[model samples]
Target: MIGGSGHVGARAARALRRLHPDLPIAIAGRDARRAAAVAAEVGGPTTATTADVGRGDLGLERGASFSAVVTLVKDEASNAVKRAQADGVPHIAFSDFVSEIGPLVAHHVARPTRAPILLLGHTLGGAATLAALHLAQDLRSVDAIAIGCVVDADDRGGPASQADFERNEQIGQAALVLQDGRWTWARGDAATRRFADAEGVEQVGHALPLMDVVSLAAATDALSIRVDMAARDASTRGAGHATDLVVEVSGRLDDGTAARLRYDIVDADSYARLSAYGAAIATERLLGLEGGPPVGPGLYHPESLIDPARAVARLEELGARVRRTRS
Candidate 1:
């Protein structure tokens, strides 16, 4: 994995080791010491490599080969993706996935790879969305999905994650949401809306743009998709020492009914940890495919390639309490 020596990437590397003990894993980063440290943590003879994206060979030996490379590097995603395409290697990106990457995805489709490129922009999206998908496993006709995540303002993520978050803020944080059967741009992730959290305690959420709006809609064929993220309320701030986040996904069924899912997790180390788990899960699933990779040479989100049930089941195993309700 590229950029696999940081807080998130390292954790992901460790997770990968736990899941695939025999798998040869490598951790790449600018700091060779740090990469070596993370490799040591994995307790395997993992390779510690430098990652200088610009210095040709992407900071690795030429003619290097792998089943797939999972990129946790943010902002530099396009470059890494380009490198993967050039090497004809399958790539899975965990961050820096935005709508603007459309062109890169299209390019991959035209050029093709030995295996499909998976962009997990909506990695595990929201608890509700996953739970809803598990409930709708029959592939029922659904028209809308209300998915949002609650994050604590004080709960800052890793450096790369913070940078990615800041970039979205630079864009005015307006999200394209499905409203009344049409696309409407909404402003900001701080517009508060009242909702009960996982514990049935009232909480607030602000609409925020995450990749769920794009990938979820496309993957599920949902005509409408709404996304938001909640920042922690001061009331619960100083009271707890654990990191926490609330994720919800609600869907409009064909019968005009609504189904919602919720998960309140306390003790999330960082978004990086969750992302690492997600990457590991996807990797495990991909490696487990009977004949070959699920989809052929093209860019796709996890929802499109992974079975929802399998995906969420793994998430729970990794530490997420998912609950579902329909009305």
Candidate 2:
């Protein structure tokens, strides 16, 4: 893993160990000490690699091979992904908070790969996509969809993530929501939305066209789709930050009936821990360790590639509560 030293990386390494006991793992990062620390925590025959993913070449030794490389870093992923493609290694990137995966995804679209390179994120894109897809199996004509999510205020997503959100929010009057088969700029422009979290607290949310706006739109071919997210209220996060994610999908049924599916997600672990679990589960799926052949080489987000049911199961296995309601 490229970012095995970070919080998410360490947690993910531990999860990966639980999932794959015999799989040799190397915690790779720029700092040997940090990498070694995480490797020791993960136990097993794990080793440390003083690899600088920012360098793109990953500072690998000649002839070194790996089953997969899961990165917790984003800023360097653009180059690192290119390098992984060159190295003929499968890659699974943790969510890019900076939203820089567009160009990378675009490039892959232009020149598809035979090696699966997945962009699996927990927020914005990945979570909502999974929720929508899971409900999509029984729905027909997904004409419209709206999802509202809430994270712990403490999770503010860090400075880089905030900067990115502000930058994107400023570029348009509101987030880029899909409406009437076209992109529209608005924030919660559809309706008043409320989310009943695991704590039995009802919270209001705003519409923000996060990455899921695009990925979900494409995945469901829905003409109208939007995602709204906010930090869980301060009162809830005062003690510690646990993520409270909610999603809703709506459309017409094959029998011409209206249908909607609402989802709730609660994870006791911190956001990074939840993300670590997600990344590890996705990595296992991609590696085909749990069975089934790989999806073959291609640039894909977790939603486009992974089976939604399986994905949900993995998240719950990692101590997350994911429930859905359909009507």
Candidate 3:
């Protein structure tokens, strides 16, 4: 993993160690000492390596033998992705890019070569989407799918994450899902929804367009996919800084049957920790399975490649709940 040293990266490294103790995991970061510290914490056969994501050459030998490479570094963003493509490495990108950033980074990574690239975006990106797919297994066609999230405001986030959010705010609002097969670019407050979870139901969410929607739209035949986010336990007006998430997805199955899926994640740590778990889950998926079709080069959601049932099982093991309602 290229960004194995940071908060989410480190957590992912630790999770990998627990899941695959014999795997040779390496944590990379700009700071050598910090990377070493994280490797130490993860223990097992894991080792720490120093690599600058900002620099083109990550110092890896050409033709290095490795099954997959994960880019968790936040600073270099697209640069690391390009370099990985140059090295002809199958890569898993960290979940940092939002739809407002445009397609520059994703496009660049996909433009280079046929190397498989998976861009991890949002905790709901892969696992949650997969859960939706699993729920839709009994159906034939689906008109739309809406996934909702309630994240704790107080969750710790890294500098890169903070920067990404700031950039989105500066860039204005993003696309919101509309009825039929339409999307509208609306202001942040223009879209809002009510969310209820283990904590309770509250009106929350903004017009934040997530890359997961983009990836899912590309991956599945679902005509329209929407994601709304809110805080679980508090009202939108007084939601203090706490790390929690409540997501609900509604759509029609292939047979024109209506269906809905709900998922909630309550993390005790800050935003960074929750994000870390998301990244870690992706890494585990990449390393754990085999014989799957190589996910092509481009930005991808977790659901695109991983089995929804498997993803949900892992999340539950990590303490996230998946809920479904029968109609």
lDDT, candidate 3, 51-106, per-residue tens: 77666666654545555678765544466666656656567766455553344355
Task: Tally clashing residue pairs in candidate 1.
Answer: 2
Give the candidates in order of lDDT, highest first. 2, 1, 3
> Best candidate, lDDT-wise?
2
For each candidate, the alpha-carbon lDDT, in order, equals: 0.62, 0.70, 0.61
* TM value for model 3: 0.80
* Comparison by TM-score, 1 against 3, better one: 1
Residue-pair clashes per candidate: 2, 2, 23
Q: Cα deviation in Å at residue 158, candidate 2?
A: 5.9
Model 2 gets an lDDT of 0.70
Evaluated against the true structure, the overall lDDT of model 1 is: 0.62
> Each prediction's TM-score against the native?
0.83, 0.84, 0.80
Off by over 4 Å in 2: 97-99, 106-111, 121-125, 157-174, 187-200, 206-209, 237-241
Task: Output the worst ten-in-a-row residue range by lDDT, candidate 1.
Answer: 123-132
Error of 3 at 324 (Å): 3.4
